[model samples]
Target: MSNPNSLVEGWARRYGRLEARPSNVNPLDEFSGLSRRLRGLRLKEWIGFTLLHPDWYSSLIIQDAHYLASSEIYAYDRAAAALHQHAVTMRSGSMPMPSALFGHRYTAHRGDYSIEYEFDDTDGRHVLAIDIAETATAPAISGELHLDAAHAGRPLSVSSRLPGRRSRMYTHKAIFPAGGVLRVGDREIVYRPERDLAILDEHRSLLPYRTTWLWGTFAMRAEGGVVGANFVDRPEITGEAEESCVWTPTACEPLDDVVFEPAEPADPDAPWRMHSADGRLEVEFTPEGRKEVKRQLGLFAIDYFQMFGTYRGVVRGAEGSYEVQGVHGVCESMRARL
Candidate 1:
């Protein structure tokens, strides 16, 4: 599906800009010896995951970022207004790159967090197991989520080379049915396939020195079926690969650039409005709470905010229009110099 000598870029237009499930393409083979260069030190990779239930919000994020291994866990109970957050950072090697190609197995250990993702060919699903050992400072969080990829449709997988630099990036986004029992402290949050969903955002990119982007995603029931979306706005995306799309029960509908308008520029908990440039999508997000991170370590700096919220919107596609009513999801704004 790609030329050997050329950097893999863009999805096939005929395929709705969606690649086949379980892609075999590996970016490492193309990145090769570039990881040792000064420019390559800016490369960033991470896996951001979200599990959605009706009344609960949970996220486990692992980053082999720039030159540090970092992980975070955030869980919130909307009814009780309870929030649990823990983050740890350590100097370590980069995350396993082959996991993006085939997803055989990979693990990241940071402080008390141990996160693992393994693919089981027998059942054609990816199992995500997260174990956070209880310490004097925090409680334990353990869960094993089974992401049913065998039945999920194709994913939005795209690759592109930067315009004026040697930087390149590969990103994969998929929404699939998932069920699990996540225990946080003494409370148990259960997810059933019939009513819950999961969204996986995986990225392995050789980024520039400074990068910024606005990203939003959600999965929920709408119009008698399930519909999910991934909207992103990045200036470096030279149109060779537009990684924005709406995932329906049948196909992934490709979308043009999306605009994010915040009611209050600096407030992460404010209501945000989003619309597609072509007028095919419009949504309003009202955030309940946010996990905000701002830190500066010498030459490295990061200001990131990811807000958990509910979305109300309309998405017009070839099949029909999907209306989402107060569905749970997340939106993020990030600016980093790594």
Candidate 2:
């Protein structure tokens, strides 16, 4: 019933202090633009971001892409590292986010990413959504999955799917390194390289099923510090990268012109592959190196589907002519009622 971490609540109270202030920023103006921008592009370029906590019993849903830019930690890292994530372009044009989606995009630089949803009721694209990403680290479990001395966070948590579930809360804190704090909370974790600050958790809600969810962001630093970036939370399990994106330094914005294509899986236990438009990148995430952080609450069997390392392959922005490597991190899993 209550988010154990109380992150959303904390965010509401401290959002102003931690992130930049525009005073009159509107969610609809920021998020809904995704559709109009891509109105001319092929339908294949539309994408959405979402977070799903699935288990056998109760599940929590968080859907956001460009609702608000309240956290500077994200806004800064995302805008700073635009090359790695949204390799194509964050938006198609400038239409604004759909009023239905409950999310926002935050970055120190507004030109790096974009947001948009398909306007199915009247045509060109039948989707509506947004995506947020930065050069930050996601929650992790040390090098190994077991309770190691360096392990942090809630020690890996899991839950299941229960439609219409109430919002669960948790303190958005991480055992961050020196100066790695994003939006000040009880703790901080490094999501960026070196400091590796964890891309701490935030508040989440739900979108209609059959609707996609692509959540989380990632990027890499290259020559002159030009970062290619993208964020996705495709929770539908259908395996689509339309909402998943990656972009370069110039022309980056939210819900504008973002798109991703999942690469074919080579191994049964490896991270899946994905590519941004124009084949600038060939990125894949491997979960084989992760240790399972499991927890069971009610009919839900939740596990932090984590791999100690990550699998990455890029050519230009983040990838370099068919290059490949393993990345270390954890993947989350939750199962709830059918």
- Top candidate by TM-score: 1
How do the residues 1-338 of candidate 1 rate in per-residue lDDT, one tens digit apiece? 43222223343212123344334443444444545455446667777788899988888777776577787888898988877877778774644645433447767776668888786655477888888877776678888888887666447776666544766766777776788888888888888877888888788677766778899988886544568788988775445667788877777788887999999987767799999988777999999988889999898899998899899988777788888889899999889886
| Cα-based lDDT for every prediction | 0.75, 0.28
How does candidate 1 score on lDDT?
Answer: 0.75
Distance (Å) between predicted and true CA of 202, model 2?
Answer: 3.3
Model 2: residues with Cα > 4 Å off, grouped in runs: 1-201, 207-217, 226-228, 231-243, 250-271, 276-280, 291-296, 299-304, 315-334
Clash totals for all candidate models = 0, 147
Q: Compared to the true structure, candidate 2 yields what TM-score?
A: 0.33
Clash pairs, candidate 1, are none
